[model samples]
Target: MVHSPLKLDTPQEWDLSDLYTDFDDPRLVEDLDSLQQTANQFRQQYQGKVKQLTPEQIVTCLQDLEQIYQKSGYLYAYPSLVFAADTRNTEAKQFLDKVMEALTGVDNQLLFFDLELKSLDSEAFSQLQASPALKNYQHHLIRIAELRPYKLSEEVEQTRNRDSLTGRQAFIQLRSVHLGEQEYPDVTTPEGKTANTEAELSALLYHPQEEVRHNAYSAVRTVIKEHNLLYGYILNAIAQDHKIENQMRGYPSTLQKQLIEDQVSEPVFTAIMEGTASRFDLFQRYYQLKSQEIGQKIRICDLYAPWTTQATPPLSYQSGVELLLAALEKFDINYARRAEEFFLKSWIDAKVRPGKRGGAFCAYSHGKHSYLLLSYTEDYNSVFTLAHEMGHALHFAWIDETQSYLNSNPPMVLAEIASTFNELLLLDSLLESAADETIRKSLLTRQLEDQLNLLFRQSTISRLELAVHQRASEGSFDHLFINEKWMELYQLLCGDSVELLADHQYDWARIGHIFFKPFYCYQYTASNIVSLACYQKYRQVGKAFIPGYLELLASGGSQDQVQALRQYVDVDLEDPATIRGALDYVEGLISQLETLI
Candidate 1:
């Protein structure tokens, strides 16, 4: 049993002593120097000899590469987390830069290894992939094979690796620091207080009170507008960087590259996009009802407003843990135990503070336990976020328990799938036990809004992303071009249910994904379509489905994405209605909310 600390924020910090003693840790410097040495030694011995290696030699070679990869993962994880906690910390920032530059150098040295492997003749490639000793790395070999067509020359690959530190990655680093260091003017609230950071203000966007939500929206707009020029410049640089890299790599299009990387076929990707976009009517209908519930026309700012004005009691950090653990217990005792370790062991950073990153992510290093980042506002959504991020932590944790480092990564959609599953589990647990109609209504509305964001909004965002990359390939991106593209997406999704706000067009200006990972948001749409169907299956079958679902998690990238999902939950990603099942589920939630209204 774990006892919660009296103050949540006090224990919210993770014990990074596990990763390093400090930025000044001699081991960090030693490890940085050692990475290049290891890479050079390995390359010197194996660069042109991959096809000549026996089974034992192949396994040994892979193990050597795995060691380097794991060390690099840990080295990168620490400074990145440190920077995330306080992007303005000059020491952490500088060390992060140094580490990134050093790793780039190391990777540049290793570039020739992959180029050599991919250049092998058909017989050599076949024999290596068929070796019994290399079975554990089969998935890794296949992943490498997937990139054969995209692999550039050794010199070009080396140049790209060397430039990564100062090119797109630098601009993304700036965006993170900029958002963290932003100072939004305080919005006075009914409780005689001010909301400061983006996370705090984001919580206000869902406040039951309309005025507070509007004020929060206005303040965010003011801050983003204040820095629009620099933000726009950063986005343009990122866009152009991708454009250059994508063209040089021979990728026909940006989305195609992302799709291949995600292990999703073009047909299934299109199915997800069209299936979700076809339901814009459901989106409009939900908002029309939401406008009536709020007793006013729903403004762009009013989108996240609660479906009710009912007040929710404040939940402390300790209580949030108990609540999430209790919810997890219904699924399985093991699930609860895994989640409990996150709180008791202090694997999570939960406090809302100045200079912390705006959104949340779970960082998993192959040999170390996962670390979670949450700008916890202690609201109801924060409670769900606790469960959601823990789902991610444990997903990778389970993978580590059973898989080798070579195949530990799942598709990016797995990130959303596990997180959203916990969210649904928590909702089901809440709705099953709660007697009050208002609480049930609130929970249902919360589910609806989440589905809205993950399904409808993300699909639209992906459409806009494709257009941005296309236009960006032709010329430099300007404010007018991005703004117009965004407005088009908003209108397509929202229909004419409410007046469109121009500030909404500037919304992409604040999205880090556009700059950091081109076309990354579609995975949310893809995962939601898959997860909703999985949840519905669980509801229908009860405990019978646990073994397969857990196996799916343990498989990591071992199985094909579509095949794994199909085997576990009978979900057919190729079918257009795979997402329609999710839309139907959302419609059901809206129906329940209607009755309560």
Candidate 2:
């Protein structure tokens, strides 16, 4: 039986006019000019006076600096968002490149402020931090002071900043444009139709038919494999660039710089990595159970296949929004109210089109609201993704409301908390209202699979990153080295449970984070553990849990994240028990699924 494609009664694209009318908008030119002028003026006034200023004067300086950045951020956000929505737009791409170059120059002029502040003597810094006028900016000041040891000369810093446009940034853009413009060949879908576009092919991974899943997976792999050489060179360039920067900055390893930026200690990161690796058996166990439930041996492509033969009904975008809003409202009405603005204001670009970037993200600027991009395929997974990105938007909304621009962006570890917490909430709402035992089982299976993906799969990616960086540190590497390392780590996690195809070795090229944001995947695992613990506490305490969670979101980067979690959400990242408990919860989930099966 063939069913018609679902027609969504929802806005397909975002109205970016809230940021700017278009590439030709006069405000764009005005803001760019103003941003550059403001930076120059700011530099002349405060470039060399950071240390001589009194505490109150320091406060005034910071406020001024914040204003400069806020303007620059507004300028950068518009073009980047435009490019992301359609990378094939040559005009948008040109505008974005121009904005980035301008911002780099502006940032070069302002680099002196941080250098001067970081250069302050211990006694003088202590005196400044002690002042009551610096209370709100205390954490911001501390972060700068912590990086004092890694500071390079002002001239070198500026050179690096300028070079990045054609260096790291250019390579990143190359990968994006290459992926965005490549036309994927249409593959057969489970419904006897065709899956065209990367998003459609990806959605077919969950089809009930194994043949459909294999065809979809193989088709994607074939394309990526054809371009493996380019992707390989891109990854190699990025890793080598990181290594050179790490050496220049005196970072102990390639990962240390990111860890420092994230405000996470090496020990905490090690614990999470080891904790997840130690539990690989649980990942294999879940897959083994899935195989039993499906009554067949499963391959890598079958990992996301539904257990039953009947295809799950397609979820319309409108229904997806209603479901997500209902789940969020049940958690907190204020959360629901804030999310509604994304739809009413057209802040989300959810249309499936060629040249739009694949996957989903919520991009936030300092003074404006967040914008989300995703190809909504009208599936249950897409609804969960909507909730996840909405969580990020709501998180930024709280930060924008409560914190100054200087303290608005949280570290990546803290950044992922709200998004994953939203997933757990959606899962709870789904399991509670599931119509029958089969539905409940499917939901539970999805939850378990999500955990596996977030925990085990992400850890594998992190390990692969560590390996590639270590190899790059010694010398340059090519595609073969990357493929071998990826497969080695991947097989370690999968064990004998899932069949590893030859094309699976090329899978590392598909992960944008590895090329774009170094060492970013591990945060997903850490945040998953933290979110699971938060959701457990919410379940135990009920309404009493609301204030602390909201306070955590509102805190932003105003305080140290570990302390913020302990103070607000009551989770300790430093303790081994926290990691153990999260792992135990995952194991318990597997057992629950076993009983359901």
Candidate 3:
């Protein structure tokens, strides 16, 4: 039987029985116990003996580590998936809390093995890599040696791990809990005061009516403003935490080590950041043209407002599945088949309900099923989100079949490629089959705006991240200071195209990335640029490029971002032309929108 689209106005549910039958599932406790025991056993066997082991013993250690990691995945993801679906559930929260402590202990037990490996000198690591038995493990060892240069002493490492629960994690939980309990009234829709969470408020920013949209933004801004002192203190503390850690680790700056971890050099990161800024003209031109289309000056709140005269009707969940599945079919039969399973096997939770976490994410369990959490609103945008997460599912599915658990984690810089690629395919399919000029125009506009969002807007926030982190290091990350500093970034990012209001000053206060992962926004720009290169190849070479792209995804972290891309599509990120691909893609999108108008 075919199902209908999940209407957000009502409660819709997703089944998690595939992973666990219930909160008290017997397997939950068993899995946790198994992980703890396994970790202890592995540590006892090889913790300090890593360097002394023969090449064959090292292979055995890797095999054991893989099993341990795969088991931990099941244990960690169960409570995590439950908590995300409804953060207010007390039992779910408790389970997650207990599981985290258990996992942390397990991680500490296994920590010595990694620390010893990372501490190896270049010559020692080279000799280890020279083992033919460790041939497939070269990239993993190289990464260890590369990062070990930034490694801490055993004493410092232990203290850092133990203190995380009380330190960084406590601050993160504070923000998460506040957002969960906090509710705002949707003041725009008359006689209408619904209990709106932050997620609902943010989603309403896309409402068709201009007043409804801006009102949502206003309501959120007001709420955040009232709690500015608390939020601002939390933000600064997180930044301060990072700055101190960077200093103790002997790094030059905070983001420098992050670039290193992503296997991207500082120069490449710099070129992409500077290149996106140099083309701020395109950002201005798009918005100025949008303002003309809407017959008013664009405001910061109106940035996401749909400008098309008539948007296509709300896309249903059933139709969304069919649309995305059909798009995947053109690439490979296997890709389409896996997407079909998402609908047939009840793998997706397409719903809008209370207590659910905001935003969408795909988590692929080691050697098991891939789960996705999304608050589907049944719009053109929501359908693409489904496609996007499904892309992540498929990305891991390929890797699972071809790789071991040790090599399954792809770098964040390359992680967004599959998901965004799915969006591209779905968008092109919709545009190709669009019934009229208005529909086509809407599709084109969304593509352009999203491209700019991922490429340039993320870069702008990255700029904000750098500024705030630097200021925090100087003891100046205050509420008023953040407002003024963010305003400066606003002018740099938007120029004079969009009107900035007082409410816009506190917009940075709502950005979670600054608190969660400092200097991480640039990954979006990097991945989007790489995805564009992949998409361009598909368009140029047609079906012939499908194998290479799938092969790239299957390689996972076995190859670094640049190495994997070179093998598949010859994309050299360090090359100026490849970095400019992002700029060129935005310009192409703007040109397309111009012709449509």
Candidate 4:
């Protein structure tokens, strides 16, 4: 089916009516109220009776609990998605806050369900797990059981939930609003056009002209520097909060809580960190090759500069969609068809608008379809971003189809596999069809650069996060300390291949994950390694690998992540050789690029 190209000037926006017609939609209010009342009823019925309930009774209670959460999730997602599309929307912000507070109340009332389950004696918990009626929720029950050691008093847990709105969540929102409201000073592009707005300025960083790239870099860094103190304070407060909670929850270290939540072992994380760190020379080697190919010295600003002076033709959003679908079709027709629903049904917001959040994410809930947000610049990178988020959306679609709501959310360690794997499929399809050598070189460079960013740079960010938490553990830290540590770690990563500038110190503040989802960056490294291995297996097995891969996505969080990967992809997270093999694959890519250049 041929499709007309979506005009570059008129960006595509998502139709959010599927979630709510408007903030004032009667269903929204009804659902919000219904969620609270249902939760209240659930608490009244099961608050102190988890241990005493029979397996069938527990199944009944769990079903009610799932319905309550599914409804609450439906209500919360609407306002949050609204705010994400436009942070400056006051109504959305207020609605989101109201929903959050109400949900916190609901959550506090329902908290005893998990607490009581955790408090159960080992023999009784085993009996429940062994029941046929409880088979579906066995993994869920085991996960909660693992948290028994970290369970705080119900009162303390409630206080933390209530405080988060103003404490951690409020600070995170401040950063988002601040970034949304920023009006970057316009810089002249190499094409003699003016670059205004954050996205435009970011695009200019890849401009062929060195001066244009520097201007864009400076413009962004200037804004960040102005607000460094505020960002620094927020980071410190969040870290300190984590420290306090870590102690209260009896976590031995700051990273342990997140590691436990991800269902990843400490040794696996250590292996990834060490594996990527030991290969910094490969990172530097790639930059040196890039410098030679571009015929200019590499600088912090030039990190994203195009490999050649000749620019690749801009890809229309429609063209990008068609290209992505073609790639997915080649991989699996069913996968392509699932992705097509997103475009046809207006499930994506790809428009570049003021106050819209930067970067990209696919928002999903148990009872509703997913919605994606991204500013679709007419570039290959934007195309890859589209494919990536679609991967997430498709993964959630499968989960909704195959798993119960209670078992639907995959852990962070395995979450990026499908998305990153989609990227590789797209890359391979593009490369196979490229008729020009320059375009082919450009694609290879992109593949290599993306791996470096995900594998190397993310590990570096993880190290920086570790340092920050360590500092907070010892004492308080400010912007100055964070800035120095960021530069120090980044410079070590770059070595002598790229020149680091003073403004580069503020770059750490730009990483929203470090502030919002502490210790989350390492998952990217872990997922990339696993995804690359998955892609390699697909390349070897061809169509034979598709069923198991699709089954893996459908499995959702129904099993242990490590066990799931082993069952489907046949990859082992605990093996050091697996990490080494991934790094070896990266090294091979670098060699391929070296030959091309």
lDDT of 4 by residue, 205-285 (tens): 777788999999999899999999999999999899899999999998789888898898998999999989899999999
Range of the 10 consecutive residues with the lowest summed lDDT in candidate 4 = 1-10
Q: In candidate 2, what are the lDDT values of residues 396-424, reduced to their tens digit?
A: 99999999998999888889999999988
User: What is the clash count of model 2?
Assistant: 0
Task: List lDDT for all candidates, in order.
Answer: 0.82, 0.88, 0.80, 0.88
Any runs in candidate 2 off by more than 4 Å, and if so which? Answer: 1-8
Candidate 1 regions exceeding 4 Å error are: 1-11
Q: What is the lDDT of residue 452 in candidate 4?
A: 92
lDDT: the better of candidates 1 and 4 = 4
Instruction: Spell out the clash pairs found in candidate 3.
Output: none
Predicted candidate 3 versus true structure: per-residue lDDT over 1-597, tens digit per residue: 123342333323556777788877899888888889889888787767777878788888888888887887777788888888877877877887888788778878878877888766677778888999998888888788777867887778877877777788778777876766656765544325342666556766666667877888888788778888888788888788877888888877878867777778888889889888889899899999999988888888888778754544766666666777777776777788877776666667767767777778898897887888888765777878888899899999888988888788888877889999999998988887888877788788888888888887789889988888778778756888888888898788788899988888787767777778877788888888889888998999999998889998888878788888888877878888987886888898898788767
Model 1 residue 515 lDDT score: 81
Per-prediction TM-score, please?
0.97, 0.98, 0.95, 0.98
lDDT head-to-head 1 vs 3, winner:
1
Candidate 1 structure quality by residue, lDDT tens digits, 128-187 = 889888888887778788898899998888888778777888888888888778888788
Candidate 3: regions farther than 4 A off: 1-12, 187-200, 309-311
